[model samples]
Target: MRYNKLDLNLLVALDALLTECNISRAGERVHLSQPAMSNALSRLRNYFGDDLLVPVGRHMERTPRAEVLREAVRDVLVRIETSVATQPEFDSRDTDRTFKLFVSDYSMEVLIPHVLAIADAMGSRAKLHLRPQSSNPARDLERGEADLLLIPGEWCSAEHPSRVLFDDELVCVVWSGSRHAQQGISIDSYATAGHVAMQPIEINEPAFEQWIQAGVGAPRDVRAAATSFAVLPFLVVGSELIATMHARLARLVEPALPIKRMAVPFPLPPIHQAMQWHKYRNLDPGLVWLRDLMIAAAQRM
Candidate 1:
C-alpha cells in the first residue's frame, strides 16, 4: 500500500525505530536488516524532513519530532489493527487459531485443567501455546507476543483490559507426619518455624507469603530455598522445613506429596487471578471468544 508515494510498510519501520531508538534493535523487531532499516529511516527522514533518530554518544535517541509522533503513531496503528481485525470471521468452533498464553505456575496447576476441558467441549482444534510468564507481561501483550496473561489481578496492567477469574488463598503445607500436621500452625509457630522458601525470579505477584510484596504479619526463618514450586515437595518432606503455597495448589497436589494443608493462623489477602488482553484486541472476534471461554473456565474453577 502507498500513501503520498510512501510505502505504507515503512510506517511499521517508523514505529519500531521510534520505539526502540536503535536502528539495529528496530530492524530486529521488524525483521529487517540494519542496512534496510537505515534505508527506510532515510526515506522517512526525507519525507518528514526530520532527523527522526539521532546518535547521542554511543546510543540513538529519538528527536523531538519523533517524540511527538510516538503516541500518535501508536494510536494510528492500534486503530488500523482494530479495524483490520474486526473484518475477520472468527467462529471458535470452526477456527483453528493458535493462542499464546502467559500462565503462572499456580494457575497452570489449578485452572488450566478447566480451560482445556472447556476447549475440548467446544470441538475446536485451537491449540494453546503455554509459556512461563515474564516479569513484564504487559509489554508481552502490547507487543502481540502473547494473546492472554493469566496472573493475579494486582499484576494486571491498566494498559490492557482485565477481569478476575477466581480468588485463591494462602495455606500452610506440611508433611503428613510433621508436628504442624498433627496440631496446627499458629502465628508464633509460623514465625519461629524453619520454612522452605520457593524463591521466584522476575515475578511481580506471588500467591503466598513465601515471597516478598505479599507478606503481612511476620517473617519466617528461611531454611531452604527452591526456584520453582515443583521442587517444593522434595524440600518440604523429610525435613523440618514447612512450606506455604496457594490453597488450591495444595489441595490439588495433596494426595501425591504426602502433605497436609492447614489454614494460616494470620489472615492473608485473597488473590484474584485475572485474565488480561491487549486493548487493541478488544474488537478481535477470535480473541473475544477466547476471553469469554477463559472467563467461563474461571467461573467453573
Candidate 2:
C-alpha cells in the first residue's frame, strides 16, 4: 500500500491494540468508547486485509501480520506523538509518572542506591520500575513495556539512542577470608576451581564457543549456572564457589557480603554499562528530561 493512502488515525488505533492486546483495553487506551473502538477495529481489519487480533482461548492473540506491523505502528505513533505534542516539563520534585527500566539484577545492586539518593536529593515524586533484562529488548521497547533499557555497551543496538553510563572491569570474587582469596589463581587454578557463572547481558551458547575455540577454557568447574548477574556475589559469599563479575558491582556488594575481588588469572575485557532509549523518543520532552535524570544518577554513582 502507498503511504499516502494510509489513514494516520488508523495507525493510532493499531498502536492501541498492539499495546493493550485487548479490544476493550485498547479502546480505553485510545479514549474511544467501546462501540467506537469496535468500529475502528473493523475499519482496521478492512484496511489491513487481516484480522489484526484473533480470539485465542480467553485472551486476544495478535495475527502474524499484526505482530509484524506492531513495531512499525508503534514507531510511527511515537514519532507523531513526539512531533506534534508539546513536551511536558518533568519536575522530579513533583511529577508522579512511573518510569519503567530494564536492568540486570547486578546493576540494581550497585546502581539503585545511588539512583535513589539522587531522587531523594531532588525530591522527585516519580517512581522507578526495575525489571530484569530479558532476551527480547526490542520487543519490550516497542510494546511500551519498558521505558528504557540498561545494558552493557556490547549488547546495545544503534537503532536505539544510547549513552554510556560507566565502565567496569572484571574481578574474581570469593569469600573474604577464603582460601582462594589468599592463594594464587593461575589459569589452571581458575579452570579447576568451583565457581558460579553469570553474564550481565544475555549471551547465546555459540558466543562462548569462540572463547573455547581460542584455546580459552570454559567454567568447567561451575557449581551452578545462574541467569541473573546479581546473584553471583551472594552465591559466592555463601558458598565456596567463586564468581567473576563487574568490578563496580563487586565493590557495591563487598560491604554487605563476605566477598573479595581477586585478580583474574587470565585476560578479559572490561565491561561498560549504558542506558538506551528508542530513537522515537529523541524529541519527546518528558523522555528527554527523564533520560537526563538517569544520566545524572549514573554520574553520581
Candidate 3:
C-alpha cells in the first residue's frame, strides 16, 4: 500500500535494516533476497533523501537520521501489531499464537516445565518460544520483541506491569562426598571454601549471591565460573567447590546429581520471581490468557 507517495511495505524493510545495520542480515530477517533488500534500501534512500546506513570500518553504522527513526519506527510497528493486527477475542483451544518469553536458566528448569504441562492439560495450541534472559530485558519488552519476561522482581521495569510469580531462597550446594557435607557448612567455611560461581553470559554484573556476600563484607575464593545455573551442580560434583544457587533449582537437580543442598550459613533475602509485560499490552486478550496460564503454573509450583 502507498501512503503519501511512499510504499508502506518499505517500513518493514526499513525497520529490519535500521535494527540490523547489515544489508544481508536484514534481508535474511525479512526473508528477502540480497538483491531485493538492496533495491529496498535504494528506494528508501531516495524517499528519505539520505543514506540510512554507512560503512564504518569493517562494520555498518546507522546514520544520524537512522538513529532518530529507530525507536519511532519500532514503536509504530508495535502499535500496529498490537492494536491493529491482533484479534478482538482470544480462544486458547482454537487460536494458534506464538508467545515469546525471556527467562533465566533457573526458571527454564524449575518453572517452564510446569507451564508447558498446564498448557497441554488445558488443550491450548499456543506455541511458546523461550529465549534466554538478556541483560536488558526491559528493552526487549518495550520493543515488543518478547511477549513476556520472567525475571527477579528487582530487575523488572517500573514502566511495565508485573506480578510476583513465586518466591525462592538461596541454598548452598556441595559434592556429596565433600568434607563440608560431612561437617556441615558454617559461615567461616562458606566464605573460605573454593566456590563455583554463576555469571550468566548476557550480564556483566555479579550474581545475586555475590552481591549479598559483598554487602556482608565476606569474600569467597571463587575457583570457577559457569554461564548456566544448570551447570553449577556438575561443576560441584566430585569436587570440593561450593555453589550457592536457588533452592528450587538445587532440589530439581539433586535427584540425578550427587550433590547435597543445605541452607545458606548467612542471612539472605528471598528471590521474588516476577512476570512482566509491556504496559501497552495490559489489555491484550492473548497476553491476558498467557499471563493467566503462567500464574496458574506458578501457583502449582
Candidate 4:
C-alpha cells in the first residue's frame, strides 16, 4: 500500500472500533457521534478491502487481516496523535492526572521520596502508580500504558528517546557485624562468602556477565536471588549474606539497615539510571514535564 494514499483518520476510527467493539463506544473514544463513527467504519472497510471489524454476537471481532494489521495501525495512530495534539504545558496544580510509571523496587527506594516531595510542592494534584518494569518497556510506552520507566542504561533501545538521570558504581554490602564487615574483602574472601544477588535477565550484556563470572572461582555462592534490587539490603542484614548493588542504594539503605558498603573486590561496570520513553512522547507536554521531573529527582538522588 502507498503511504500517501492511506487515510489517517480512518486508522483512528478503526483502532477505536477494534478496541471498544461497539460503534457508540468507538465513537465516544474518538469524540465522534454515532453516525460519524459509522461513516468512518464504512470508509475504513473500503480502504482496507475487508470488513476490518465484523459484528460477533454483542461485540465486534477483527478479521484475520485486521489482526495482522493491529500493531502497525496502532503505531501509526500513536505517532499521529503525538504529532497533532497541541503540546500543553502541564500544570500539576490545575490538572489532576494520574500517571502510571513503571519503576523497579530499587527505584522506589531511591527515587520515590524525592518524587513525592516534588509532587507535594506542586500542589499534590498528580497521582502516581508505581508498576513493575516490564521486559519490553518500549511496548508499554507505545501503548500508552506506562508514561515512563526508570531503567538501567543497558536496557536502552535505539528507537526510544532516553536520558540518563544519574549514574553510580556498584558496591558490595554486608552486615555491619558480619565477618567481611570489619576487614576489606579480598578476591579469595569475597569468592568464598555466601552471596545474595539480584539475577539479571540474560539479555547478553557482556560487561555485567564478565563481572559476575569473575567471582565464580572463589566462594561465589548464589545463596539467594531476587529480581527486586531493594530486597538485597534487607536480606543481608544480620545474616552471613553479602550483596553487590549500586552504590547509591548502599547510602540509602545504610542508615536504615545494619549494612555496610564494602569495596568491590573486582571492577564492575558503572550503573546509569535512565528515564525512558517512546520518541512519540517527545512532543507531548505532559510527558515532557514528567520526564523533566524524573530527571531532577534522579539528579537529587
Q: Give the TM-score of candidate 2.
A: 0.81
lDDT of 2 at 89: 65
Error of 2 at 201 (Å): 11
* lDDT for predicted candidate 1 compared with the true structure: 0.81
Q: Tens-digit lDDT track for model 1 on 1-301?
A: 9988888898899999998989999999989999999999999999999998999899999889998887677767766877875547787677668889999777888888898999899887778999998988887787666889998898889878998888877778888888888878777777778888677686643645544223435566778877666567667886556887777877777888878888877666787889998888886887888888888887888
Q: Rate the local accuracy (lDDT) of all candidates.
A: 0.81, 0.75, 0.89, 0.79
> Can you give the TM-score per candidate against the true fold?
0.82, 0.81, 0.93, 0.76
> What is the per-residue lDDT of model 4 for residues 1-301, given as tens digits with 9 covering 90 to 100?
3356877657778888877778999999989999999999888788779998887887778899888777787887777667765346777777777778988777888888888888788785778889887777777787767878887777777888888888888888999998898877888777778888876463233245466676555335879987767789999888878898878778977898888898888767787878888787776777777887887776666
CA shift of 100, model 4, Å: 2.6
Best by lDDT: 3
lDDT per residue as tens, model 2, 14-110: 8889768888898888889888889888988998899989998999989999989998887766666557663456566777777789887767877
Specify the poorest-scoring 10-residue window by lDDT in model 2.
206-215
Give candidate 3 regions above 4 Å deviation: 1-5, 215-218
Clashing residue pairs found in predicted model 3: none
Supply the global lDDT for candidate 4: 0.79
lDDT of 3: 0.89
